[model samples]
Target: MLEAAKAVFITSGVDAPAKEIADLAGVGVGTLYRHFPQRSDLVKAVFQREVDACVAAGPALSANHAPGTALTEWIDRYTEFLATKRGLATALHSGDPALEALPAYFMERVGPTLGALLDAAAASGEIRADVTPRDLLLAVAGLCAPVDHEGAAFSRRMVAFLMDGLRYGAVPPEPRG
Candidate 1:
């Protein structure tokens, strides 16, 4: 049901009807309601699920791919995850108390995962050691959240540029003495 709701939310916005979600899930509205009694409940659950999935990918990606490749692909996957959040943006800012903790949860879980990725990449000398996970996370989030009517392509291109920057001068900065 959460997966169906996520798809529906991505395609139709968070305001999409519960019936649509229920239909996609092949479940009755009653069933959907039984699990997630409120829209906020459903939204929160879907967001948490997506976050978990994204964070979980980091380890598997590091294990399966080269350090640089894993870092790159994980960021791309993170971009897609960010795209999904576009639909939820409105609801998130609607001052819904239930949704208030989502941003914190996102940072708490995603930050550590990204930190692990960065650490591995730095250890392998695949990227600059000076880069911090929090900085990278904020940078990507800022880039992924398009502005001035910009499209996904622009965000993606900018992210690629950022990745290049990370690769450039892949060494720690000189001491500030």
Candidate 2:
């Protein structure tokens, strides 16, 4: 049900009706309500699920691919994750105490995972050593912020440029005269 809600939310915004989520989940609205008594409950669940998936991808990606490739792919995935998250930002910041902790939660869950990826790439000499996980994550978030169906290509180009910058000094600079 949370997965269904996530898909619907991506398409229809977090303000999407419960019935729409239930219909997509192939369940009745009552079931959705029974599980999540409040809309915030449902939204929180979807947000947590997305966070978990993005964090888990880091290790799996690193294990399967080269450090540079994994980091690049992970950044792309992180951008996609951020796109979904933007939909939930309003509700997550709605002055509800329960939702108030989410930004910290996001950093806690995602920061170390991204840090590990950054460390791996730097250790492998594939990217610069100066870039911190928080810095890279913020850069990706900024590039992906204005994301829409039309702006996705522009976002990709921006991310690619960021990635190139990350690799700018993978080899030593030429000696100056």
Candidate 3:
């Protein structure tokens, strides 16, 4: 049901009817309500579900690919997750105390996973060692924000450019002539 809620929230915003999520989940509205009890409850569950999925991807990616490739792929995943997260962000900032812990949860869970990846990439000479995971996370979050007249592709290109900049520092400096 959380998956259904996430899909509906991503496409239709958090105010979308509970029936839509129930239908997508192949359950009755009663079932959804019984589990979540309130719209805020549903929203919180969905957000946590998605965040957990994104965090879980880090280890699988690191295991399957080289450090640089894993980092880039993880960034792409983060971009997609962020794109779907704007609606949830609205819910979190809606003056509801229930939603307050989510931001901290996101940072605490994601920061270390990203740091591990960054550490591997830097140690392997695939990116600069000077970059902190927190800084990179904020930069990506800013880049992922939708700008007027620009779209995801533009943000992606900008992020790719940032990746290229990181790679630049990985290159050894030329010896003085």
Candidate 4:
């Protein structure tokens, strides 16, 4: 049922009516409400599921691909995830106090996995010491501009450049003593 609700939410936006979710889930309205008392509850569950998927991708990518390649692909996936969040932004910022913790939720749930991947890349000398996980995350976040906005492409290009700059042998500007 949660998966069905997420599918509907992703396709129709979280503001999609409960009846729509119920119909998609093949369940009655009473059942939907019984499972999720409020729209915020459903939204929270869906967002958490998405976040979990993204977090889980980190290890899978590292295990299957080279560290550098994994980091790059993960960044792309993170950008896509943010884009999906942008699609559901309306529901995210709908003044639901319960949903307010999502940013923190993402940090706690996704940040560690990202940090581990980044640390591995750094240890392997695939990225620079100054490059923190949050820096890469912020670059991806920057890609999530206003929907239908022209700047999104430019943002993506810039993030690509930034990620490329993170490759092995990237050098920090020398400090003058």
Candidate 5:
């Protein structure tokens, strides 16, 4: 049923009707409503799945590759996720009462998971000490700052630059006060 919602949302936007979700799931409307009483609940569930998948990838990537390479690969995957997420973000931020809380929910779930990965990479000496998961999040958000149409390749390049700076300590040192 959640998968149905995800498909509908992805193809038709979060505003896709509950009936459409139920039809896609081969479930009754009552069943859909029973599982997710509100439209926001359905949307949140769909978004959560994507977030969970990306978060889960972090540990798997780190386990399979050297720390620096793993972190680099993970950031690349994250940038891709953010590209898709621009649509989700737009839907969530549409001022619709139904999606009002989704932003906070997304951050709460995804932030800490990425934090763990970033910490692990730092401990392995793969990235600089000043790097934070939130900083990475913000950087991805910045990469997505341009218009969404042709922004994907552009954002990925920005992510590459950001990751390079992170790995090599590109920022100038501050003078002691």
Candidate 6:
């Protein structure tokens, strides 16, 4: 249900009917309600699921690719995560205290995972040593902000530019004459 809701939410926003989510999940509306009781409940579940998926992808990415490649690929994943997150932010911020806790929750879950990736990349000498996970997250968030579907390609190029910046000085300058 959470997966179905995420897909529907990306296309239809969080206000997309519960029946739509249920239909996509191959479940009945009653089943969806039995699990999610309220729309907020469903929204929170989807949000947390996305956070979990993003967090989980880090180690796998780091393991499968070189440090620089892993960081770049992970940034791509983070961009996608941000895109979906922006879609649901409005509904999640509508004054529910529980829902309001999600931003902190997102940082708590994603922070360490990202930190580990940064640590590995820096230790491997693939990116500059000064960049922190918080810095990267904030930068990526800014790049992705004011989400414009039509501007996705532009956003991606901007993110690529940011990644290039992170790699600045990764190779020591040629010895001066």
Question: Which candidate number would show the highest TM-score if scored against the true structure?
Answer: 3
Going through the candidates in the order shown, the clash numbers are 0, 0, 0, 0, 0, 0
TM-score on alpha carbons, each prediction = 0.90, 0.91, 0.91, 0.80, 0.73, 0.90
Per-model C-alpha lDDT, please?
0.90, 0.87, 0.88, 0.79, 0.75, 0.88
Candidate 5: which pairs clash? none
Residue 9 Cα positional deviation in candidate 4, in Å, after optimal superposition: 3.4
Candidate 6, residue 32: how far the Cα is off, in Å: 0.8
Off by over 4 Å in 2: 147-149, 171-177
RMSD of 3: 3.3
Candidate 6: lDDT of 26?
A: 100
- lDDT by residue (2-92, candidate 5, tens digit) is 7777666656777777899899899999999998997777767777777788788888987898767877887787776665565466678
Residue by residue across 66-163, what tens digits does model 1's lDDT show?
A: 88899999999888888888878888888999999999999899999999999988877789888898899889989998689888898999899999
Displacement of residue 139 (Cα, Å) in model 1 is 1.3
The alpha-carbon deviation from the true structure for residue 95 of candidate 1, after best TM-score superposition, in angstroms, is 1.7
What digit string (tens of lDDT, one per residue) describes model 6 on residues 34-143?
99998989999989988999999999998899888888999999999988887697887888876998989999999999888887887777888798888999999899
Superposed by TM-score, candidate 2 places the C-alpha of residue 73 at a distance from the truth, in angstroms, of 1.0
What is the Cα-based TM-score of model 3?
0.91
Model 2 clashing residue pairs (backbone):
none
For residues 20-47, write the lDDT of model 3, one tens digit per residue: 9999999999999999998999888888
In candidate 1 the C-alpha lDDT for residue 27 amounts to 98
Off by over 4 Å in 1: 147-150, 172-177
The ten-residue window of minimal lDDT in model 4 covers 167-176
- lDDT winner between 2 and 5, please give it: 2
TM-score of model 2 vs. true structure: 0.91
Which regions of candidate 6 deviate over 4 angstroms? 147-149, 171-177
User: What lDDT score is found at residue 140 in candidate 1?
Assistant: 90
Per-residue alpha-carbon lDDT of model 2 for 1-177, expressed as tens digits? 998998888788888999999999999999999999988888888898899899999999999999999999999888888778877877887888767877888899999999999888888888988999889988888888774665667887899999999998774334569
Error of 3 at 157 (Å): 2.3
